[model samples]
Target: MAADRLSALPDDLLQHILSFAPEREAAASAVLSRRWRTLWRRESALDLDIRPYMAADEGQDLRNSPSPLDALLSDAVAALAAFPRRGGGTVLKRLTLFLDLNDVDSSYDSVDDPEPVDDGRVAGLLADPAAAGLEEVLIGCEHGRMRTTTYGLPLASMACAATLRVLELESCNFEPPLSPRRAFPCLTELRLRHCFFKEGCLQAMVDAAPALTSLSLDRVSQQPPDSAFQAMPAYCWVPFRLRCLTATTLELKTYSVGAEEEDLARIGIELDMPSLRYFRYTGDAIKLSLASPAPGLSSVDLNASLRGEQSQWEPTSRMLVSFSSTRALKLHVNCMNDIIYGEEEHGGAILPTFPNLKLLELDEFFEYTSSSAALAMARLLRSCPVMSELRLNLNMTRWYRDDEPKTNDPARSPFAQSMDRFNRLASMTASSRRVSELPAVLTDDGAFTCLQTSLRKVTLQFNANELDCFQVQLAKFLVENAMVLEEMHVDDGNTFWLDHLCNKLERWRADSFRRRNLTDTARFRVHHLE
Candidate 1:
């Protein structure tokens, strides 16, 4: 009956059913019968995938085939054109094209310099009125070593559709003749990755999109570097209406530390927009200052991974990022070896205080001394008086190690000395007066009480054999202190130990009055060996 009912459905319903299949599979459905033959052609949505159709034999014989790239493009164009029209009208609503160009091998020495494929066949298909309603376009091509420069996209011939909103280009060249203005008028979201353009081409592209809300540029090259170009001015462009901006791998060979500091200061002084909210930059270390102190910004992520001997780690400028309206903050620094030498050399410490902060994640934070790091952490916690969630991924690699040799006697090993130092450091943290100043949720003792009273969930992840005395002490503290804890999610490397831990808890409940009190006041749900 279901099959009978499906057979009675209209072409639109049948086409929608077939749309779930891969593009090639969906096209194959047209061979079922005359009625289905024309149904795929009239379909409004088109997903043109050319990867599966590529043949290893054909690729191997590329040298003998006349214009391999052009031939492929022509076949794609013909396939789209051959689709049956609905009421003699084109039915293309959205189109996605993926191209994987193979590398030209040096062994094919017989082939002379090949002509670049100016394949206008696919471009011509996009210009048809029936396909004019395309709302999204994605073009991606694989990179090869061939230095075979293909012509830019024929975006100028594309008819602007009112419904179009997104345009993405990946590893493709956009030559002259087709400017951004003539390409996309109603576009709102644009992403460019590993694209090459002229000096002002990017700025012009952004200027043309009046309604653009999001922009991302990664590894975009303007011009090749020159030996004489050692220092360049720091670049800054403000999109008054942009709400999100992300830039990665942006390289400037001639920028000075002083110039970067000044540019950040200028940005802080010049731009003031209520709509701007999210900003992310990952490149060489650069100073960042907020214009009007981003009172409305919600989040900020900055990561710099610079290499080479000349790479400097100190934050040269004071970046007072004021996030009066921010609720979430994430700070990540990879290497801090260069910044630990002198207080005067280090840029002003980040003193961000979020009164209403709810979530904070700090990763790879390091300092030479535990006291300084602890004090800084205390200040940060104090700033977030109402903070509910905090995560610290600290690497204390250098703090506890003493430079002096521990023993002149051959009997004592370095391993034993290292263990002694580790115990001493653990004791210091346990007895430190500074621990009293942290938030009630983070204090060693307070952390246990909070787990018992306010904590609704607990997650413990550790390797059983790898668990040291520090981990044991922390685990015991948590179990003894959590008064209102409801559930615990644990991942112990050994299943036997996991089961033993659960059984011990159950037995303690069966024997101890304290356990009885816990059972009455809280629910202990254990998920072990996960």
Candidate 2:
């Protein structure tokens, strides 16, 4: 025996080590020795993933009997019941449970028959004495694709509201507590994804969680306005107002509604987070408005399409103005459609100057063939006077290239004709018109302070076998113009043309130095994306 040094460690430390293992494996450690038998029972963290224990459903028929999912749930409840009680006992600090029922064929099964696993039993875990001081809980459920019902989590049954600090729930109906006061008194972080809220449940939950500092709502929706619950008091639907005073970081994404409800959805968003420092929003349309300026907000990322309705441009303009104080900014290509076309239509500046911005990242989803993209790039460069780094992600998928060899095989005629039609449509819809010359913002002397002095690093990402002419021109323009640039990185996401791409980039480096009348000190390199 090596003096059993590991066993000599403190009991709490040993339990902490065991907590990382699966619950069943951790409990199995009890058979090792007398000292270890009870140590696993006192562990403070539990991760109950029922996927491994689920029996194979390939050939088994579960129509008449309770599902393995139900069995696992019962086993989990029994395990929780075995933990030590409240007074002077070990307090569970964290619990994470993941239940996936995508393989089960339970669409036609009646809820009254097998008494679909009571959601309250899972929520009641918080009421157990073992969870007296529980601080974190993550519950994720993926129901069968064919099933019509969703799990309804009973929020009122949670008993660790005063001590809980973090909570996350996914794919469920969030039922608000009966009383809002003192609910989730100590909670500081909350995330809800793919969830449905009752008429006013979300508002009440927000009102109750006063100490919350971070919140994320992804694909969260509510029932239609015609629900039976709205019959009382002649319930009039209102825009979802998220008025968090203490939250410093917030994310709202994909707030989608039907076309008939588009006007209501666009009515507006009310945000009152005075201390916010970081904000990221992703959607196809605009629906956000801050109640007041967040003086402390410093970083913002906006990912939305601004090409459709004129109504979206004004709100986007207002949003950019509010984010003028931010130091870092990222914009998707769809966002530039509005700024570029709006500037063309209105013949004026459609964006505010980002005086404080030091870093800028632009994301593109298609091949860059028109000068509208160049103009958009120029306008952004001119706005950020002191930006030091620039990143361009040209995630090109497919496009028409006239230089490529044409196919003449009769067997591929149908597919080739269809692709040619698609190529034409993409080109026509890409921009209303095209121009030959680079925008004056790039050609004129002293037009951009960032390019003249401050800009030091540049990164361009491409995902194609060959670079588009527009892409090559943009790269050449940047290399020849950025006087103080020290490093230029080209991420080659191509599969078969790595060697060709590398050689072409080398030539660009030589040509840029020769054109600029400067020494080429190996300032650029090409990297392959794995």
Candidate 3:
């Protein structure tokens, strides 16, 4: 440069500029000049990923002691210690570590290897002097073998607690904190996935983060109920009960519904976040108790494993009452059907009206199967008077002929029954194709207010090679009834046969415009797989 102006900039400003570059590029800048020789060492962020250093060829072995990645990790930790402190701490403000601890050591060669992989080397990185100034931290481990041997999070010794604002930990075991006081006073967002907690440890950890605004816990479970303690009824099992006064967004997902019924029944979720706006729950539909009404709640996404049982129906109705104030909702097809059928089973409790609902998405939907399901769908549409958008994922695999026998065997496993029904449907797909008659409830011209007034956009997704007969009927009904419809999007999952599907849609769109006496005003588009 003519005046060497770049080197004249302050150290802090230069470090802040280098923070946006990749770690390797930032480190390589040291050779540019004398002023930049030690500048990269004090950059405010570090993101170290071990996957690139992993040697896939047979010549390089990862199991050897002091492997290349292991040595690099050690060197990085040592380098962090050498950074001079400014304002009582180093300038590092963000740190991320992506680790694969599955085959890190040669000792883990056999299934019954007595030696456990040492996690202290990874934990030591956080103990560095640079971590005291960290504002955001993310540590994620590989999912497969790492699930069995999880990294124990050493929160008690972490120096970033006072300054951290965001923390995300995946595939780690939580160690109970040494104190009950707040550990992350300023943390606003916390996400824990595939983590295990003992009885009281989860609540303690949540209570420590008093300022959290967004929280997510996926597949976080306590120890399974002991089989030998048959007489105890699993009372020692602590339900996930919390009363976060500050959180506005929450997502909770559980393991699959293979656990024993008693264990499932004992796993209750109780939340008292009065300020909550968005909530999503995906798992077996267990007991949900909301202690306070959330008047500000805007969106809800509930994906529950449902069955034809009275116990499941009543609880679901109570859940609907809790979400009466939401403006947007997403549900599975069974959930939509069960809303009416479930309330009928529970002594015809008056269904709550979604006065503010605008958008609704129904996944795994089968169009107009049985009269009860049709009636349920009609009632649901009638409730959302102001709904503007509707999305349906047409599940063609569940379609069957009218002459097939219905199977409701309780003793047989659900998976086996599903596979059997799928095989039957596959065999009859080509031969038993017939156009289905529209349900009388849906055909009623004035039954659905949303369709007549507010419904504007409709989206349909078909994953099967051939569209079901009822799917076509449903499309025609929407085009005829939705008076204010703006656009219809058809997303077909069959890649090779997209042209065939598009041709069908084109003919239908032309026919729809003629039926409505409108000339090319509606927008109909087909989305093909890339």
Worst 10 residues of 3 by lDDT: 107-116
Per-residue alpha-carbon lDDT of candidate 3 for residues 1-530, written as tens digits (9 for 90 to 100): 37977788999899888877656778889889888877877677887766655653237654565654575587668657656642334477888777666755434332122123546665567777668888998877775643544566666767888888998887566667777663889999988877666556777777888888999988775543455545432222225677788899999887654334435454567789998999998876666768998989999998766554546323554556778789998876353455564564467644577889999887755433455545656767887899999988755434442333333356768776566556655666553543354688878647688986788888877543334445556766776567677777776543223233545655666676787787754464544434
lDDT of 3: 0.67
Candidate 2 stretches with Cα past 4 Å from truth are 1-10, 32-35, 56-65, 85-88, 101-119, 143-148, 223-238, 306-319, 334-341, 344-347, 366-368, 395-397, 401-441, 464-468, 492-530
**lDDT computed for candidate 2:** 0.66
Give the alpha carbon lDDT tens digit for every residue of 13-94 in model 2. 8988998877888989988899988888788878887676565544567676556667667766776666665234667788
CA deviation > 4 Å runs, candidate 1: 1-23, 33-35, 56-60, 66-68, 80-88, 102-131, 144-151, 154-157, 161-163, 175-185, 223-285, 288-296, 299-324, 330-348, 362-380, 391-529
Cα-based RMSD of candidate 3: 8.7
lDDT of 3 at 212: 87
* Pairs with backbone N, CA or C atoms under 3 Å apart (clashes), candidate 1: 41-84, 230-254, 231-254, 232-254, 232-255, 268-291, 452-482, 452-483, 452-484
* Whole-model lDDT per candidate: 0.47, 0.66, 0.67
The per-candidate count of clashes, in order, stands at 9, 0, 0
Per-candidate TM vs. native?
Answer: 0.61, 0.77, 0.73
The deviation in Å at residue 500 for candidate 2 is 6.6
Positional deviation of residue 1's Cα in model 3 after best superposition, in angstroms? 18
